[model samples]
Target chain A: MMIKRLTNKLLMGIIIFHILALSLLPPFTFTEVKAAADSPGFIIQADWVVGKNMTPSIVFTETSGSDKTPMLRVHYEEAVIYGMKLTKQFSTPSGPVSLTLKADGPVRMSGMTVDTSSLSFKGACLRATENIPDAGLEDVTMVVHYMNAGGSNIEQLSLQTVDGNQGPAKPKKTQILVDLALLPYTQALKEVEKISSGKKPLVCDEPVADEGDVKPGEPKASIPDELSREDLVPGEEVIEDRVGKVTDPVTKVIDPATGVIEPVTGITDPITDPVKDIVKPVEKVIKPVTKPVKKVLKPVTKPVKKIVKPVTKPVKEVVKPVEEKLKPVTAPVKHALSESCKRVKDTKGKITKDLGLDLIDQALKEGKTLPELCKGDASLTRALEDFEDGLTDILGLDFIFKALGQDEEAKLKRMKETLKNQKDNFIISL
Target chain B: MEEREQEVQVRSGFSKKAFWTSLASGFLLLGLLLVSFGISGVACAVPIAGVGDFYVKFDQLEGTGYTFYPKLGETSSSDSSPQGTNLIKDVTIKNLQLYKDFKVGGDTIRVLITASKPVRITGLHHDAGLIQANAKFQNLTLKENNSSNWQKQFEQTSSKITLENAKLKTHYLFQETINMAGMKLTVEKIK
Candidate 1:
C-alpha cells in the first residue's frame, strides 16, 4: 500500500513540474524576416548605346494620362544630372546634321519631361555644337517643338555657326521619337504585368470553406482567429519528441563511470597520452641534476642580494630629497613662463578686437577692398601694417625682395602696364 | 629822396617777361588741377554694381596673393595651415569686390555669377562679395594639398576654370600670363 501511494505521489510531482516548465517557456519562436533593399532614385536607358563619354539622346514616353493632353513628368528631387547631353539629328539642305546640346556644368533640374511632342529645358544655359562634315552651309534652319504654359507649340528656329568669341545661341526645336526598349523594368512594373495577365488573385474571389468539425450556420473562422487558435494551442507532443531526440544521442555517448562524453574522451586521450609519457621520463632525469644546482645557487645569491639592498636604499633616500627640493625651484619658473604666454595671448586678442580686425576680415569676405576697409580707421590701418610686418618678418620677405629686387620691380611694372592696357576689362568702381 | 629811388629800382626789377612767365605758370597749374579732378570724377562715376557676364583668363599672373603664418608657439601640423595645406595665414576678410572683363586671346567664354555672400578665393588674392553665374572650365586639375610637387603642378598651364558663388581660399596664386574680358570691379563702404 505504501509503495503504491509513493508511486502516485511521484507521478503527480512529474506532471506538475512539466506544467511549470512549459508555462515558463516562450509562447512562440518568431523567425526574423529581413526587409528588401531600397531601389535607385531613377534609371535612364537609351535606345542607341554609345561610348561612356557620349550621352545618348533619351525619349520619355507618356505612359498614363488623358488622351488629349498626354503628359509624362519626372521629378529629379533637385538632383544634379552630370554629363547630360541632348542630341538632335535632322536632314538639312547640306546633309544629315547632328546637333548636340551640352551644359557648361552639371545641370540641376527639379522637374522635367520629354513629352507633348516637344523638348523644353528651363533654368539652364545650354551650348550647342553642330557636326557638319561638308561645311557647305554657314547656317541651317530646323523646326523645333516646345511646351509652355499655353501647352505644346511648334517653332522654326535658325541655327548659326557660333562665333569663336561669342556665346552660343539657344536651340529652339527638335523632333523626338519614343524608344519602347528603354522603359525601366522595376518590381512595380512586374506586379502591373501580372495583374494585366490575370495571374494575380482579385479581392472579389471567395475564400475556400473550412472542412471538418465546423458546424453549418456558425460564425466562420477568420484568418486572424485561426492563427490565434493555433498559437495558443501548444504542441506538447512535438516538444517532447524533440527533447527525447536531443537527449538520446547525449545518453549514448556518455560514460557511466566518469560522466564524461565518450566522443570528447576519444579526441583528448591520444594528444594527452604522448605528452604525459614524454614529460614523466624527462622530469625523472632532470630532478637530481636541478636539485644540487638549486642548493648551490641559493646559498651564493643570498649574501649578494643582502649587500645590494642596503646600498640601493641609501642612494634612493639621498636622491628623493634632491628631487623634492628641485621641484619647488623649477615649478615657479615654469608657472611664470606659462603666465607670460597667457598674458601675451590675451593682449593679442584684445588688440585684434580693438582694431576691428575681425570686422575687416568679415568685410573682406564680403568682397570689400583693403583701401575701402582702412579708409577712415587710422588705428585699423596701423594694426594692419603691424600684422603685415609680422607676416613679412616670419616669411623673410626682406630677403626675398632683396634677391628678386630688379626682377620683382620689372614684373610689377609689366603687370601694371598690362592692366592699364586692359583698363576697359579691369574696372573698379563704387 | 632815398625811399623814392628804392621804389624805382623795385619797379624795374619786375619786368614784362617775368610777369608773363608767372601768369603762364599759374594757368598751367590750374589746368592740371581741373584735369586731375575730372579724371577722378570719371573713376567714381562708373558703378560696378550691375547684372552682367564676365570672363578672365590669366596667361601670366604673378602676385604674393594671400599669405598666412602660424602664431607664436604653434606648429605647422596644427590647424593653423591655410586651406588644409602647410601654407601661411595672414589676413581674413569677409567681403572683397573684384570686377573685370576683356579678351586678350581668341575664343573667349562669358560667365555671369550672383550670390548672397562674398565669394572669396583665399590663396588667390582676388575677392568678390557675391557671384551668381554660368561658368565653364576646360582641362582643370586640382593637386593634392599634401603633395610635394604642388608648386611645379600649379605652374603648369590650365585651359580654363569657372566658379560661381564659391568661397575659394588658397595659399597663393602665381600665373605667368592672363587674358580677361567683360570684367568689373566694385568697392563700397559697409553701412
Candidate 2:
C-alpha cells in the first residue's frame, strides 16, 4: 500500500511536470525553429546579445502558401546597404570587401555559431530583419548609415554578418514541414512515426515555377526584349513565382503521381497552400501528443480518466472562484486604458500648443506660410546676434503624460524615440 | 531495594530529558548552519562572508597598478613591512572592500588600478634569506621617482624586503606600472 501510494504520487507529479514543461517548451522551440529557418530563401538570423538589448529577432515567416515559402524581412531603417541585394538570394556577388579590421571588427562571422559578434545596443540599434529582401544568396554587408531627424544621410560605421562561404549553404529542398534543430527533441512522436511506421517525413514538394514557367533546369523560351542586367538581378525576379513556392496561383495542378508541383506552362489556376503559417500552431499541439499519447495514453489515460473525473470537478470548482476574482480586474484595466489614452491626447495637445507651430502648420497647409514669411528673415537675423537665439529652448515634456500611470515608462520611451527618430511622422508633427 | 528502584526511575527520566534536549539542539544547529551558508534550500550565487580581517590588496605594492584596487577586506594594507617574505598563505580573495597604504621610507608609490577581478595568490612565504622574484609585464611603462630612489631602496633592504639593484629600480624608480588590475605579478623573491 505504501509503494502504491508512492507510485501514485510520482505519477501525479510527473503529469503536472509534463504539463508545465510542455507548456513552457513550445515558445522556445517555436522561436528557435523560426530563428533558424531552414528554407533557402530565409536567412536564419541568430542574435548573440551580450547585454540586455531589445534587439529585433530575425523571423522566417511564410507569407501565404501553406507555410511553405519563407520570406526573409530585413528592415533596418537607419542603415544603408553598400552591397545591394540585387538577387532574390541576398548575395554579395561583387563589391569592395574590407573584411579585416581592429579586434572589435565591424563585421563578424563564425562557423555555425554567432560569437565575436557582440553588436548590441540599449534598444533595437542593429540591423533589423523585417525588411531584408527574401533572396537566396547567403552573405551581404550591412553598413548602418546614421541619419539626422532632418533626413540627411551621413557616413556611419558599417557592420556585416560573416560570409556564407564559411559554412555549407543551406541545402535546397522542399519546404520544411518541421524545423530540424527542434528535431530528435520536439516532435519526437512525429519522428517516431517516420521511424516506426516507415512514414516519410512531411515535405511540401510543390514545384515553384519561375521565369515564364521555366521549370528547374529548363531555360526560359522567350526572354523579355528589353531585359537589362539590373533587371536580371535576382530580386527583380518574379515575386509571382517566388511567392508561388508557398502558393501556386497559376499551376493549381499538382502532379498526383510525384506529389510535386507539375511543370504545366501557362496554367493560370491559382491555389492557396492550405498549410501556410499553420504548421507550428497545429504541430505544437500534435507533436507533443504524437509520442506521449501513443505510449502514455494506454497506461496514463486509463488512470487519467479515473483521476480526471475527480480532478475535473475540483478544477472546475477552483476555476469558479478564480473567475470571480478576475471579474473585477477587467474593470480596472479598462479604466486605466481609457485614462492613459486621455492623458496621451492631453499631452499631445500641450506639446503642440507649446511649440506655437499650430497656427504655422495651419497656414502652411493652406499653401501660404512661415518660412515664406521669413524672406526678410535675414533682416531680423541681423538684429539677433545669432539666429538660434531667436528660438526658445524646447522643454517641459516630463509632466506631459503623468497620468499614464502604469504605461508612463513605455509611453515616455516611445515619445523619446519619436522625438529622436522623428520617424512615423509623429515627431515631426509634434 | 526500594531506593534502588527510585534511582532507576530517576536515571530513566534524566536519559529521556537528555534525548529531547539533544534533538532540539540538533535542529537549532542545523538552522545555524543554513544561516551561515545563506541557504534555506535555495542558495545565493555568491557566498557572503562575515566582516573579517582578511582582505585582498592589489594596490598596496607601489608598482601594483590601479588607483583603487577593489577593497576586499575590513582593513587595508598597513605601512608595516612584511616581516617575512611569505606575506600571504592560503587566502581566498572574496573581492570584498579593502583599504591599504604602501610606503617605503615614508614615500608613497604610484598604483595602477584594474576594475576587472582580483588574482588569487597562495603559499607566499619567503624560503631563505633571499626572496627571489620573477614577474611578467605586459604593456609595462617605466617612470622615474621625482624625489629619491636611494632612501626608498634603503627602507626596502632594511625591512628584509630584498629588491635587486635593478628590480628594485624597476619597481621603485624605473618601474613599469601596468595600467590594468587583472594582471598579477608573482613575487618569487619573497615567496
In model 2, the runs with Cα more than 4 Å from the true position are A1-134, A138-430, B1-191
What residue runs in model 1 are displaced by over 4 Å at the alpha carbon? A1-71, A77-80, A86-430, B1-191
Residue-wise lDDT of candidate 1 within A1-430, one digit each (tens)? 9999999999999999999998897754221110011110111212211111111122223111111221122212123344433333222223222333334344433222222222233211111111111111112221122111101111111111111112223333232122222234354344334433532211101221332222221222332335434455565221312222254444465555856655544443445534344444433443445434344334454444434344544443333434343444543332222222233234543333222334334334545433334534554445444544443343224323342365633333222222222213232211
Candidate 1 lDDT, B1-191, residue by residue in tens: 99999999997785778765885686467445434533342222122222232222221122222221111111223222212111211212122233233332343322222222322222222212112234322221111111122221111011223333333322223222112222232222221
Model 1 TM-score, 2 decimals: 0.17
Report per-candidate DockQ.
0.01, 0.01
- For candidate 1, the chain B TM-score comes to 0.22
Which 10-residue window in model 1 chain B sums to the lowest lDDT?
Answer: B149-158
Put down candidate 2 lDDT per residue, A82-165, tens digits, no spaces. 222210111222311111111111211111111111121111212221112221211332211111112111122111222232
- CA-lDDT, candidates in order: 0.28, 0.26
In angstroms, the error of model 2 at A213 is 6.4
Model 2 alpha-carbon miss at residue A394, Å: 20
- Candidate 2, true inter-chain contacts retained: 0.00
Model 1, first chain, TM-score of: 0.16
